[model samples]
Target: MHDRPAPRPQAPPARPPAVRRHNLGLLLGALRAAPSSRATLAAATGLTRGTVAGLLDPLVAAGVLAEGEPDRSRVGRPGTPLVFAGSGPVVLAVSVEVDGVDALVTGLDGQVVHRSRRRRDHRGLDPDAVFGRAARTAANLAARTGRTVAGAGIAVPGPVRGSDGAAVLLRAPNLPRLDGCRPAEHAGALGEVPLLVGNEASLGALAHLGQADDFVYVSADVGIGGGIVVDGRVLPGARGVAGEIGHVVIERAGRLCGCGGTGCVEVYAGLPALLGDAGAADVAALRTAARAGDPAATGALARAGAALGTALTSVLHVVDVGTVVLGGSYAELGTWLVPAVHAELVRRGVATGPDVAVLVSPHGRAATVTGTARAVADRVLGEPDLLLAG
Candidate 1:
C-alpha cells in the first residue's frame, strides 16, 4: 500500500481585533465637563477634527447627545458648543485581592457596578495564573455591561518598580509569590488594551486626594502601606518606594519583618502581626470586635495603633502634610489611634501644631482601583494624568 499522505494542518480562524471604542458616556461626559471648546479638545487630545468627529457623530446619532449650534461672534473661526447627550460610558474596575483572588468591577465614574470573590489555591499559583483570572473576570464584566470598557486598573499589594509602565513589586513578606511581576505581561488576557497596576496604598491615597489638597494616606491591611501627595501629585521616592512607612522600624530588634529586617513597624502594626495565635480573616474584623469591647481585639488594635502612631509622628515631622488620612479597615478605629499618634508626635520633640489635621480617608476601599484606572486613562489620553482620573 502507498504511504499515507501527511495530513494538512488547518489554518486558525481569523478573529477581529478589538476595536478601540470608548464608552459614549465617557466621551460625552468629557465634552460636557470640559471647560473649553472643540479646539481645546483637539489641542488636548492631539487628534484631528476628523477623529473627534468620527468619535462624536456616532454618539450624537445614538441620542446620547445633540450637537449645539455654533457661535460666529468670536474673532477667529466659529466655535461649536459640545453638550452632553445624557448617556455615558461605563468603566469596569477591579481591586485584586492579595490574600484571596477577589475583584470588584465599577463604572468609569467610580460607581460599583459588579463584584466577585473567589478562593484560590495560591500556594503554587504564579503571576501568569493570577492575571489570567483577572483578565477573564474583566472580559466577562465587559460583556455583561453591554458597553465598551474604556480600561481596567489593578490595585496590587506592593510597589510598582518604575515610572515607565513596569510591573509591580511585592514587598510584603506574605506575598512572596508576586515578587517581580509586570502588568504588561498580563495585559493580553485583560484585553489587549491598556492595563495599569499601582500600589494599593498609593491608589487609595489618590482616591482620597480627589477630595483633599494635601495629605498622608495610611493603610493598615494584610500589610501596612501609604502614599504621600502634595497639591495633587504622588510623591514617588527616588527609588520608586516613597510611602513605605510600614517597614520603618519602631521597635528595634523587637520582631522580624518579612523584608529580612528585625522589628520593622509592620511587625507590630500589620494585621497578621497583631492577631498572633488568633485565626482572624483580616484587620477589619479585628477592629470591629475591638470596638465591641472584645478584650483581645481591643488590645491588639491599641498596640498596633500606638506603633502606627509612633511611625506617623516621624512622618509628620518630615512631611508636615496638611492632613493625615487613615484608611483601610482599621481606620474605623481612628478614634482610638489618633490620640496615641498625637502623643507620640509630642514625645518626638515636635510641637503639636495647629495646622495638621488627622482625617479618615473618605473614599475607603475604592481608592486603589480608581487610582489604577486613572493611570490607564493617562496613557490613553495625552494629558498630564494627574492624581485624579478626571
Candidate 2:
C-alpha cells in the first residue's frame, strides 16, 4: 500500500481556509453596512491595517469596491474611503407566491435596477413545473440586465428548514404541491448562480429593518403567517416556525381550517376566508365594497381584524413584541382592518395606543421581494471571494 500522509495539527495565529473566509466575510459585511477607510474597516473587523489592506485590495481590483477621497473631518491623518462599485454586480431576487412569481435585480446599494412579474395562476400546479418556470424567469431577468449576477434569493410561502444549498419547504398549505420539496431543485430548476431560500414572512421581517427594531409582522394572504423580530433580527425558532400564528386557536368551536384544526386564526383571517365570507372577488373588490359602505365586506374585514388581534395577543403575552406591522395582501386594505385590530389589542392590554400599535408596510406585497434582495446581497457579501472567482 502507498504511504499515507499524517494529519495536519491545529495551528495558531495563521488563518486556515475557514479563518480566511470568515475574515473576508467580516470585512465585506462591514463595507456593505457603510463605506469606510481601511483604518476604520480594520477597527470594525478587528484586523490589522496590513491584513485589511491585503484583503481589500483584491476586491477593489475586481471592481467590487471603489476608493473615494479621504475624509478630512476625522481627527488623525485620513485615508481614502472604499465604497461598493457603482456599476458592479447585482443580486437576482425572486419570490414564489401562491398566485404568481416576481423577480428583481438590485445593486449592492439596494437600488432596484430591474424588476418583472409573471402574472398567472400558480395554485395547484405541479411543484416542479412552477419552480422551473420561476428559476428560468429569474435567469432571464438577470441576463437582460447585462450585469454580473452575484447570487439569488427565493422567498417561499412556507417554513424553510435548511441552508442555502439544500433548503426544504417544510409545509405550504396554500401551495400544497411544494410541501417537502427543495426550492432549489424540482424537475431541474437549480441554476448556475448561488441560491438562498427563506420563508417569505421571515425575509419580509428581515427587510423590515429601520421601521421597527422589535415588532410582529403579519404576512396576511391566503394564510396569515407572523414574523417576529427582536432587536432587528428575526427569530427563526427551534424549527423555522417561530412566527407561524396561523394555527393559533381563536374560536373554541368555530369553522374547520385547512390544517385540520377548528377555530384556528387562519379560518377567519386568511384572505380566502375573508373574501369568501364577504362575497368579493379579491382585495380590490373588497375595498371598493367597503368604501361604498357595503355591510358584507365591512363586516367581514372587522371580524378578520378581531381574529388577527386575538391571535396576536396570545403570541404577545409571551414574546411581548409591542408593535404589529401588516404586509402582503393585507396592506391593500390595512385601514379597514387596523382599527379593529388595534381595539382588540388595547382590550387585551397588549397595546397602548400610538406607542404600541398597528402599522402597515409601505412596500406591501413587494416586501418579501425586497427582503429577498437583501438576503441575496448578504449571501454574496459573505463569500465575496467566490464572486471574483466567477
Instruction: Report the backbone clash tally of model 2.
Output: 0
Clashing pairs in 2: none
- Sliding window of 10 residues with minimal summed lDDT for model 1: 381-390
lDDT tens digits, residues 1-390, model 1?
Answer: 111222333553432333223332234346634533555554556654544555566545654345566656666666665664334344455555665544555443445566665665544567677667766776676667665555666766777766433656645345567677775576466664456667778766877755676888888777788998886667767664789888887878678877778878888877677777233466567666767888777666667777877888778778877677888755666776766665555666554555566677665566666665544543443321211132
Q: Clashing residue pairs, candidate 1? A: 25-88, 25-89, 26-89, 64-85, 65-85, 91-108, 167-182
Clashes in each model (backbone N, CA, C under 3 Å)?
7, 0
lDDT of 1: 0.62
RMSD of each: 13.8, 7.5
**Winner by TM-score:** 2
TM-score of each: 0.69, 0.83
Instruction: State each model's CA lDDT, in order.
Output: 0.62, 0.82
Residue 136 shift from truth in candidate 2, angstroms: 1.1
